[model samples]
Target: MTMKWKGWALATGALAFSATAMAAPPSAEMISFACAGCHGTNGGSAGLTMPSLASQSKTAIVDAMKKFKSGERPSTVMGRLAKGYTDADFDAMATFFSKQKFHPTTQAVNAAKVKKGEALQEANCSRCHLEDGKEGKDDTPVMASQWLPYLQMQMDLYQSGARKMPEKMAEKVKPLSKEDLDALLHFYASVK
Candidate 1:
């Protein structure tokens, strides 16, 4: 009788656990499907002007979304779109994107600029961006293989004060001539 009772209790416990799990909210992958239209499947952007989200740190994605929601970050569409999501949704989407593989952008670059950009990246940006900008530390987004136009747009925003950047990054970027900026862009796009 004792053995039978133990088996029955185990089965009942398993059933209850399954019920609870089933009752939980939609998963991160499900929530992330909504982002595919603009961000591409699994956070890789196909659009030249849109920044890809794959492999970016979860903190980076969440922070950007939070800023968009709060109007702390300027955007043409993100600000409006961000208003609809709950914190849980933001977290879920971030988690989903952070785990996806980064698909590097394929585009033409000036070989001379690429060489100069590589040197510049090593000297100035590698501390946080690491791996030729293929890797990011903490909240830093990956720079390697990102779209040139998108990068250019972002740099322009940083220069114009339309977007905020970390003080150190701004300091490093502020002094660069336009040619230097172009070289940096070429270098980042060259990273595979």
Candidate 2:
């Protein structure tokens, strides 16, 4: 090839390489490390109040982060933390967390409450929160094997209107008494 043609070819090749590198998505592991401090390594939270993100649905993670970022979701720290991330950042982290396996935390729960909770879950929540609340559908988060305290906190938020609950969920939970709520928590905690 002529020298001038060869130079032009090299320049074009270099430009293409640079564009390819820039177009590549961000590293999921690198971006997700920011979550390890609170959500635990690979999103399996060790803290009782922090819900585990591992094995959560990607859509759920993205929606929650977006709400937190927009201040639509009430939170002490997540809102602040989420504000710093972009849609791409959220997608990367969500993809990483969604792929990790969820390991349930073991806790002692009242058997009686678990029974009532099971019945309540089947009657009211089964349609959406399938797999006995272990698996999530669409934007729903996994409820089974979640931290009991976290579950309680979220329920309290929904009940108090601090966090917006879905219309169906609100209708279902509206008639439930405090005791009934506690029973549901126990039932979720009991699920493996």
TM accuracy, model 1: 0.86
Clashing pairs in 1: none
Worst 10 residues of 2 by lDDT: 15-24
Candidate 1, residues 1-192, lDDT tens digits: the string is 255755675777854655553355788988898899998998888898988899988988999999999998889999999999999999999999989998788888999999998998888888988899887668898899899999999988887899999988988987789999999999998788
Clashes of each: 0, 0
Off by over 4 Å in 1: 1-24
Q: How high is each candidate's TM-score?
A: 0.86, 0.85
TM-score of 2: 0.85
After TM-score superposition, the amount by which residue 57's alpha carbon in candidate 1 deviates from its true location, in angstroms, is: 0.7
